[model samples]
Target: MDSELAAASQWATESNAAVFIRLKTESGVVQAMDSEEGDEEENEEGEGADVIEFHPEFTYPIYGEHERIFGYKGLSINLNYAAGSLATYFNIKYTKRIEQMESTSTVALKADDIDTPMRQILADSVCATQSEFAQQVVHDTRVFRPSGRKVHEYAGRSSQTEQLRYEIYSSSFNDTESAKYHERMQAFVLFFIEGAQFIDTSDERWHVYTVFERLDMNGQTSYSLVGFSTVYNFYCWPDRKRARISQFLVLPPFQGQGHGSALYSYIHAMVLGNSDYADLSVEDPSEAFDDMRDRNDMRYLLKHNAFAHIKGARVEQSAISELQHTHKLSRRQMTRCIEMALLKMIKSVKSQEFGEFRLFVKRRIYAQNMDLLQALDPDERKHKVAESFASVVDGYRRVLSLL
Candidate 1:
């Protein structure tokens, strides 16, 4: 019995490794291959001709905290999508599944069944079988104009002669047409964003923004879903409101090409243009998103005349107030932007300006963590503040380089 129990252990596989996700396009322009070894691969023929294979960063949301799938050997779960419309195709396969029960003359042992847990997690309308998914009918994205008011359009970052065009559309959850698309698109937040949950769509305060790539090929035009963002409007007072960005994601294959920056800039512009939005905020932004936000925010400040002359280590209260009221920037965000602007002006570390900047950062750090720092000895508090200042400087330098 001991030997038999030990043998069962080998059947368990890491859920992250066993799962394979892919995007298949009708033009055959994008393809992601699955492998038992789980190595990353990208097949690029030219611009937008590659599909990068990836695994889930966190599967705890699907398979519990340990993220382990038991009772199976050689398991492969594929979650495929049609590129443009994002129609889903889900398929699961396994070489050997442990029998659910072991019976004897007088004793019986039962093991847990697989597939039941996953079926409940995935979307109900996904393709049921591999064969059905293989015959997927691509939606007519050419005529599929996004349902909402067309807001902003721009050229791709690397475009010069052949400008790659992209458009952004905004809609509210109240729109029935847009809500249907949101239901199909929300699954991406689960797969990509950490600690993300589906929002309550019944609420009228929820809004969505979608990005699509406009492809004009051989006298035909089509739009491909590149990424999207969700925002919730909270009433602040009698008339004011706060717009908080809840979820932001750029598809894996379409990432690192300035789509995230474009999406964020469009959302930021909407907030700045609208008088109803008192301020803009984000809900639990990840590190990568934070870095992007920092870069974008600083760039905006630098372009404006108010922040162009900011050079001192000391953060000015008047300037902070101006940013808060005029640009809808929060106090914390304005302070960070001021620090980054000061860092950009520094010529050398040995200069008096650099020394003042370090001191300024240390004071801010100490004030923020005063309650925790007061618990420690005076000498230790100073040491902790210095460590935090060093970390902040390192991060600022990294974000500045991206600009």
Candidate 2:
């Protein structure tokens, strides 16, 4: 029994460099053999596995110039079909081939153009092609109840609106079932992101906080998990703890309703509020998350009167300290919040207030670009300064717009 199982596993684990696809039809399954080594018997099995062929070396210019990000080892695609119809689609073509493919109407289709005939050919098909190393976009995402920090009170300051509620889970290695759910939940990030990998939770450093909406119908409250965040606690010097946010995701349905801001506020109040927390960090935040971070941090600082003293020529270290001491923000976060607060004080881009704000940003940029000042010619230097000024002002404009 063990030997048979091992043989089946070995056969299923075989890797190929060509695309494997099966077409589900009313008659039976039909396989497409594009590779030299593809087998009918081997293809008949392992329907759930991924298989594909590869080019020796490939580059994706769409991602960036000569983007070798995926390592270009192999490509796997499943033209999924169910109920005798095409349910999902996959397309893979070399970057250089796209220009040629789109030019012909008979043999090629535009990027957005859907081919109905192609769908019929591969409907209800399974294709498996993957390399030696396994890839899992998501692990487990089922979050168990009463697992972490639950904020029950609504219509209060802790949340943006009393109608919404969230819980912050403190996950570790010992919580077996909850941890699996967390792994599965991490898979959801692939819906919005391209590259997402599972984290080994055996290490004790990870702290997972999941947010959910508390639904109450006829006084029967149920929790629907909405979003989750994973933070790694790193021990700093002097025995202080630095928490770096690894992943922060708020589901699409709950987004744009201030739930993200509310969750952030709760994290700050729960983690950074404590004396043990030295600072907070994020891991390669997306542009949208950065905007949300700026807005929420500024809102928190503004509410605490820390930003009140930094307006109208009041940019002082002591004033910054007041915010730092209250929020326990890292040096980088504090500086960004200060800049955002300074920009918020401005009424218009045409006014003197804007000039002061511009000067404030430019002065820092100038000091940082001293080496540039020494390198560029005088005419080029002016253009560089204007470019930097515009870039900084554009960021301020975004912050202000979000506010």
Candidate 3:
């Protein structure tokens, strides 16, 4: 669909004319009739007549405006239109690409010249309107072909998806051969995900968690590549036994199946319920990942039943620490979760109400820098406080948006 749309667009541009489409039925008959013709035979024969205009947008943009293309070079700036409104129309699809068809979808009326591969095309994706946002890629049975063969498989002794037919494994660098397939899967993220980076999976401290869908071919059971995440064991400030999640990607097609959450939770649960007692943390999380962490962490924290007792209490550093200890969350993660919960405490955002929350959050951000803050002159201290407060409030807003 992406390529077909692009072709229609390119053809229109080249000919200095408009592009139209004809729909073919199951029996390979083009169906339609033009009212202006006023011929009953034309209507009954199913000869093409209804012509639709063609237009296309980059649902999966692989190129930048400045890149060179046939008959075009540098940016093709179309500033006469609003860019903000186009944002939702072209964000990476939130629905996993694995399951490719949405039964109740209309089509997008756009096209481009870019040649997209079959695997990259979302045949089921609909373009109901030119203004449709990426998140609106309606519900579908998302699936993914990891492109990598199953190198390892293990069952979850206790998990939410225990009855499902699939396997997840935590493998290290020792298996050099299967690691290559894992590497092949990274390419998918390059196109569908923004700011995705590859890491050194060779380090001994690096552990990979992978999920594979079990398939049957020629009467034999095999596993297809699905989704994966990477975690690196980082040394604690004073201890040497802490792990931090580094890179995470659920191939576009494999999303919406809870695979990403399952992968994250399985590893997190291991850190929380491990016998050796190592701490868990995330290195640097993207907005989407952070939202996932917020939901997962909050759920885990709520399990203690102690959370209910302090649901209405002011969130303090001590409470953050207690939740961390109870749920195996890093100090940073617990603080973030608390900030999200604190937002729920807003009875109103009137002057005093909002200021108290601001002071509370800034108090935490400035706690470690108090010595530096104290050494400053009075004016400088006030300036620093104002700046710090503003910064924390901005971040709090972003978290709230995610929540």
| Candidate closest to the true structure, highest lDDT | 1
Candidate 3 at residue 11, lDDT?
24
lDDT of 3 by residue, 50-83 (tens): 2111222222233443322332212121101011
Q: Indicate which candidate wins on TM-score.
A: 1
Cα lDDT computed for each candidate against the true fold: 0.75, 0.53, 0.50
The CA lDDT at 10 in model 1 is 70
lDDT of predicted model 3: 0.50
Count clashing residue pairs in model 2: 20
Candidate 1 structure, TM-score to reference: 0.85
- Candidate 3 lDDT trough over 10 residues, lowest sum: 78-87
Off by over 4 Å in 2: 1-146, 149-166, 194-196, 218-221, 311-322, 347-356, 366-382
Q: What's model 3's TM-score?
A: 0.52
Candidate 1 residue-wise lDDT, 89-133, digit = tens: 666677788775342333343333446666665656677644344
Displacement of the residue 392 alpha carbon in candidate 1, Å: 0.2
Candidate 3 positional error at 398, Å: 9.3
Instruction: Output candidate 1 Cα RMSD.
Output: 5.3
Q: What does the lDDT come to for candidate 2? A: 0.53
